[model samples]
Target: MNETIIRPNPSIVYMIFQLKTNQPSSKLIYSIGPNGVFPDTQGMLQQHSDAISTVIDYSQGETSEVSYLKLRRSHGVINMTSWSILMIMGYIIARHFKKWDPIWFYLHASIQTISFVAGTAGILIGYALSKKVDANVNNHKNIAIIILVLGILQVFAIILRPKPESKLRKYWNWYHHYIGRILIIFAIANTIYGLSLAKEGSKWFLAYGISIAILVIITIILEVRMWIVARRKTQSTNNSSHPQSLEFAYQT
Candidate 1:
């Protein structure tokens, strides 16, 4: 067995620390070098003044929440995955797969529900980051709050949806459609705003922009094709019915 002790130099002062100010076990010790900076590469240092002498380095990595930057990134990625990618895909399926009928409707509902859940998770992460850093993200935070509210409205809209035969169904449709679009718009914008503030880089921002553009183009083409198919069906049905009406009149 062996022991070595390094007592704090009482004359040393003006040391700064980061992360945890103290390791939760005991008192703190600090050191300053000739440049008035902490000798550690992080430019800060923390030491327990009363720590027991130990030759074994048994300290563990952080067991608390993940790093600040990782949390920020997760927030962006989650919301983008849910609202921008999955939610838009749901809209496309419903719009272009009209012949799928109840199946398409079910798929649409299921996907949007999952999207809301993921977006909600992202919202929680964003809130945590806000409290952790507490700076310069007002625009992103405000937009997120709006999106969350809209998400709740959409959820209630589904729950309170009118029956197909109900007189108010058309108005419900209008409300649901418009609000969903607005929520998607805000979610996408907030994601971009977050990317801009992110310290990592611009690659994610570029990728997301390209993806949303592709979705928009696909939506346009599908919308046009849907209308064309609907018009053809209506004309075919009209033409097929006239001969039966003429035949009945002649028999009478």
Candidate 2:
């Protein structure tokens, strides 16, 4: 009888999938089987594939804490949300007071400054992660860059705005308001899309939905309060300027 021996080539024998970040060693999930025996283990390998698919499918519909990697993926979303909240607060205060609020201005400046720093960090991480993640790099990355550039320009405008008493002040105000609004819209849209790409869970979606709802309520309240105040001021001024008009109407 002749002696028989077997040697399996690991690479050809097994099928393994791994996630690789640019930073470190890739993590492998599982291996199929030894070379010739792999055909014998087909049933077991199919089972493994099915189990993995089931887990991923379940995760897609679940609400759960985001993984550290997913959070890293959502860096741009976090940055833009922070920036938008600050802008919303600033706009409410400025519009309600009919003049710039120093506190609002300072807060806006601080938030934008922080956002700029965070956005830079995000860009660094995103560039590294983009190469690995299965995402549309062109649309996602290019739009994000445009939003950031616009945000920077808006900050510069805030810093270089004309004095309130200057002849160009009104024009500057319009420019500031329009540009700020445009940046905010872009930020919100990008944030929502980024949230969708967050970990396989519903938490990101819930967080985003709640944020938008709260902001809408706050904005409506602010608008109503400003309108009421403006109406009262107009009534008082009219009463003083034309007191006889009311008296004459009452007599008739």
The TM-score of candidate 1 is: 0.68
lDDT of 1 by residue, 46-159 (tens): 431211111222275322322466677788889999977898998888778878888999999999999999999998888887776544577888998899898899999999
Stretches of candidate 1 exceeding 4 Å from the true structure: 1-67, 234-252
RMSD of each: 10.3, 11.5
lDDT of 2 by residue, 151-186 (tens): 778778877989889999898988888877787777
What is the C-alpha local distance difference test score of each model? 0.76, 0.62
Q: Number of the top candidate by TM-score? A: 1
Worst 10-residue lDDT window for candidate 1 reads 48-57
